[model samples]
Structures are given as structure tokens and as C-alpha cells.
Target: MVSSSSAPGSALPGSSSPIAGPAPLSLCAREPRVPADRLVAEMVPPPRFDSVRFGTYLPDPNQPSQSEAVGVLEGFAAGLDGAPASGARRGFLGFGRSKAPKAPAGPRGVYLDGGYGVGKTHLLASLWHATPADPSRKAFGTFVELTNLVGALGFQQTVQTLSGHRLLCIDEFELDDPGDTVLVSTLLRRLVEAGVALAATSNTLPGKLGEGRFASADFLREIQGLSAHFRAVRIDGEDYRHRGLPEAPAPYSDEQVTRVAETAEGASLDSFPDLLDHLARVHPSRYGALTDGLTAVCLTGVRAVPDQSTALRLVVLADRLYDREIPVLASGLPFDRLFGEEMLRGGYRKKYFRAISRLTALARDAGRLVDA
Candidate 1:
């Protein structure tokens, strides 16, 4: 939990101390209030890793390559804990490299790149947990969240605010928009300059950022320049998100829907787009006013959410509903088809994947409610 004294910047709600810099441009403007508890909850390490030590990330028969990755991550975490630094190294890309250039003097960081659900987040979370606890000395969150905060608070102010942290852990380090790519580049440069260590997880390699739509030479060069600051390690394995979960049942049958309709006394039915719009208007609060006064939510017209922004918002809503144990009945499309092909390729993929996993579990729980 972030201590009151260490709040990122005076921009955050309830922060009293003024950051030492030029006055904020928009003093009265405020970002939507996202509960601090919710943000911290998202950053908390999963229970499975609570007792697991860095050295205990043993190799699995199914994923032969994971052992090497685990060792690399353990070393990186140790380095964060004051162990000898392993000079800047590139991620494992199955290519022999010539002798690398000497690393400059600075606090070190690591970038763990891998496939969706391949434990990059887990590794990064472990590092956060292993670090000695100090009030306001660490910042951990998804890259998107950091970027959103930067958007609400100006870039320089955000950097000044975050520079106080000894470590920054960012998940889903991806570049979609050319503007975001540039913003992230500047943010990384500033953070490094401030001597802050970063541990980030991403589905895309730094070189492959903005691969299809906005891949420009200048953008790629910026990514490469940032990549030089950290050792990039790849963790290759099958997505473990649904490995042991039961197969998702087919979309709720009409009889099942009718049963829910009969049992849920004040259930509200809504469209996916409507939900997305409500979330958009009220974000960074994941659940909006529409969710208030609702015991259950039934969403129809749930065909492929084409827009990436909407899909990401849906992930947050699913998380909120799941946390509250609110049953959801989704119709119009099967669980697997909720996102289009393009969404499955980029940074948004992992979020959508997690949303599907949680929603599938919630749908089952909703089914049980209907049966009861």
C-alpha cells in the first residue's frame, strides 16, 4: 500500500504536499477518481506466489524454456536486492549477438517479454514482493495505467512525481498509438535519468513495438534506444491462464436465461456497447453509475468488441463484477469470439484474455444461481 506521504504527485487525490516544480497547468482539472484500494489490489502479487521464493520457480516438463527464464528473473530480482549487476543484456531472441557495448553507470532494471499468460506479470510481481518494503519507494502497475496518469497529470510532473520511487514495475509495456510511443519514450528516458529502476513485462519485444499500424523508423529507433537501458529476458511457454479451468459452457440457453430472469428480482439488462460507454464516461473508476443499484447484470449484443479501447474497458468491468461477486449473463457471442483477430495480436490481447477467463468463471457462477 502507498503511504500517504509518498503519494506520486500532488495531482493524486488526497495528496497534500506540493511537488517542487512549475505550478500545474490545470490546477482545478481532475481525473476520474479510481479507488486507490482497487489499484493496489490489482498490483498485489497473486496468492500462489505469496510464499514462493524467487529460487523456487522450478522448471516444468511442459515448458522446457521456462527454467532458463526463471533463473534470469531470479538474478534480476537479486540484483534489485543489492546483488552484483549483470550488465545490460538483450532478451533471448535465438540469435547469436556480437560482443555487447559496455553499460553506463546507473541503477539497473529488467524487461521480461513473453507470450500472453506466460508468467511475465507473475515474475514482475514477485520482484515487487521481494523488494524490501519502504513507504512510497516503489510504483507498480500496468503501462497503460501509468500512461493514463501521465495524460491526466502532465508528463514532466508525472516524471517528477515518479522519480522518487526506487523501483517501477510496469506490466503490458506496449506501444499502439504513435503518440503513446513517443510519450513512453520520453517517460523512460526521464525515469532512467532520475536513477529509478524499472521492471516491466510485455507481450511485445521492444523492437517489435507498433509492428503493424504505426511502425516507423523513428518510433522503432526510440524503442531500441530505451531497450538499451535494461536487460530484456524472454519467458517462452504456453498460456497458463486456462490450463486447469473447466471448459467454458456454451452460451446460456434460453431456458437458463429465463431461469435467471425469474430468479433475479431486479436484474438489469444492458448492451455491451452501453456498458463500454458508461465505463468510458466514468473511468478510471472501472464500474460506473449504471452498476449502482444493480444486483446482477445481463449483457446482450455481446458480439466481438472491435475497438481496442472498449475491449480494455470491458476487462476492468469484468474484474469489478467478479470482485463484487455480481453474476453476469452474456449473450450474442461465444466467450472465445468476444474480441476480433486484430485485438488478439497486440498489447490488448492479455487484458482481453484475462477478461474472458474471469467472465467465464463468473458466467458459471451465474449459471449456478439460475439453477438454485
Candidate 2:
């Protein structure tokens, strides 16, 4: 947590005190509130991908599936027709009546199933760009952000808000909890029924979601119902972040990180453990807001997370920071060592691997600051 004496724009406890220039901010002290309207408005792609389009995506020349996914998704987007999905409507007699033109014969959406850093997000966002609807008629966000929106505005309100969209692109679809599985499953079903198209990218195939994370058998119907809505596209490739690229640089020294934090404009400094404690205090839905204005993140005494809960929270924070393209400078254990062997071997290992990949990329970006 933030020290009691640390005022806004003041030096955080872990940073060197009495340093010159602007004081480093502390993420531990921030508690941001995102209104329902802002949440709805910000559902578009994050800044890192704000301008990504189909032409901007570079599929691996060696991976045919990657290229194939592009063509398939493009065709899927063209089929959207920029209108609500054709479904049953109420008749004058107060009975359900099917629309004259039948809905398309096959799946109502496309699902990109692949490993981390394979450009799944790129393709998902490109599809969003390619869809023939106005920005207000389409939405793009991670599965967690979508669920968070639902949490903020009740379920019915969420459905009403999204039901009119021509396309909804969900990135990083998760199936870690049974409740989320049911919630999102029901939500997607309602949206699909409402004539709204869908698309998603995930590390796991739709059919295999929630398999190892929970007692999936208990919710097999919901899982299968979710899977049935999309045509699963399998994308196979090594992590693009590290492929043909040099490994991430070593951690910076504490003094180096603190110096950069104190001198760099818009930098926030915090001890890694204290930041984790602060994350616990704030809801995960607001993690994006917590990182609102940070240009860089500096951490000291970085070490392995103590448990699965803390590790999971760290994953969400890592994702939010990555989405905002914030550089992370840290001392102590490297990001690859932040999770234990047991955690890496567990059901949520994919999330952990993606977090490591993203953090490593950010760490590499932060190296330039030290070099300067």
C-alpha cells in the first residue's frame, strides 16, 4: 500500500526521497471510478491497436493457418450485412414469428484459437475495422472488460446496450471460473439471438474452454452452447513477441529504476509487493483506470507472487499496462520467474504465459530508458 505521508505527486516510499524534478506517482494510492457511460464508450480497441487494420496485419509466411484466418475473418465480416441478425419477431397475434429471410446457414461468428503473441488480437481488431458498421454499431474489448461492463451495469442493461451492435469482438476470452462461463455464455446467447454478430480470440479452443480450470462437466451445456455460436479457426505459431527477436534484457538496478522514475515525466514507482496489495484493494474491473496516466512503471524488490490469487491479479494488471503500452522497469526476480512451477503447470498456465510474454516485451521497451 502507499505510505501515509506520500501525497499526490510526491515521492513514493520505495523511491529515493529528495530527488530533483517531478516526484514519481504511486499506483497504490489511486482508486479510479469508471462510469457506465465511459465503460460503454471505451469498449473499442485499446490505444496500442487503435489504428490496426487488415492490411496492417502480417501473417507469418510459414503459417498458412494465420493467413487463412485473415481470409476467413474477412469473409465473416462481409457477411454481417450491417443490420440486426434475422431472428424471430413478435407477431400481431402476440406469437413468435420468424423473419422472412432466414439467418445464415452456418455459425454466427468466428473464433480465433491460438497461442500467445500470434497476432490474434491484431486479427480480431482488424476484423473490427473491416466490419461495415459505424464505430457506434460495433465494439471491441477483452472478455474480462466485457464481463466488467456487465458487472457495472446489470445483466439486462448490458444485453440492451450490446444487442444493437452489428459486431462484437472479444479478445483473450477466458474460462477460468464457472460463474463467468455461465454469465458470458448466457450473455452471448442473448446477443446472438438478438441478431448481433460475434467474434473472439483465445488461447484455448471454444470446445476446450473451462476444461482444466473448473468442474466443466457441470456446465457442459453452457460451454457447448457458447462453442456452437462460432466457427473455430485454429492458428498455430510460436510466440511472435520473441520469435526472431533477441531475448528480453536483464532487470535494471534499483538505483537505475528509481532514478528513471524520479526524472521521467508521468512515471509511477512502487514496490512490487505493495502494488500487489493495492491491486487487492481495488476491483480488477478498474485496473485500466488505475493506470490512467502512467508513461512508465517502476518497481523495486520484484519477486515471485505468493499464491494463485495474487498471481492472477498480477496477470490482469500486466494486461492493462500492456494495453496502454506502458514500459515496466523492475529489479529483483525476472518476470519469467514470477510464477512458480506449480502455477505454471496449472489450468490457468496460458494466462500466466501471456502475462510473462507481455511483461517481457514491456521490459524490453523500458531498457531504452536505462540506456539513455
Task: Using lDDT, give the best candidate's number.
Answer: 2
Q: On a 0 to 1 TM-score scale, where does candidate 1 land against the true structure?
A: 0.65
Which parts of model 1 have CA positions greater than 4 angstroms off?
1-32, 35-59, 82-107, 205-222, 244-246, 253-269, 284-298, 306-309, 312-328, 340-358, 361-372
Record all residue pairs in model 2 with backbone atoms less than 3 Å apart, i.e. clashing: 85-195
Tens digit of per-residue lDDT, candidate 1, span 1-372: 212322223332235558663221210122235554444434444333455555555445677667777776665554544322222232321111333233233326676656655666667776877765463667776666677667666777777777766578876665545577678778877776665677876544333534222222333354666665666665666556567667876676545564564456545555556656656665644342234434666666667876877787777677556545677776667777888887777656556676787688677777765667
RMSD of model 2 against the true structure: 4.8
TM-score of each: 0.65, 0.87
lDDT of each: 0.58, 0.78
**In candidate 2, what are the lDDT values of residues 1-372, reduced to their tens digit?**
223333444555556665554567888878777788988999988888989987888888999988888888887776665344434321211112334243344666777777678888988888888887889989999889998999999999999999878788888767556678678878988877767778876544233434222222323344566565567787767788988888767788899999998778878888999999989998888888888878899999899999999999999999999988999999988999999999877777878888999999999999888888
Among the numbered candidates, top TM-score falls to 2
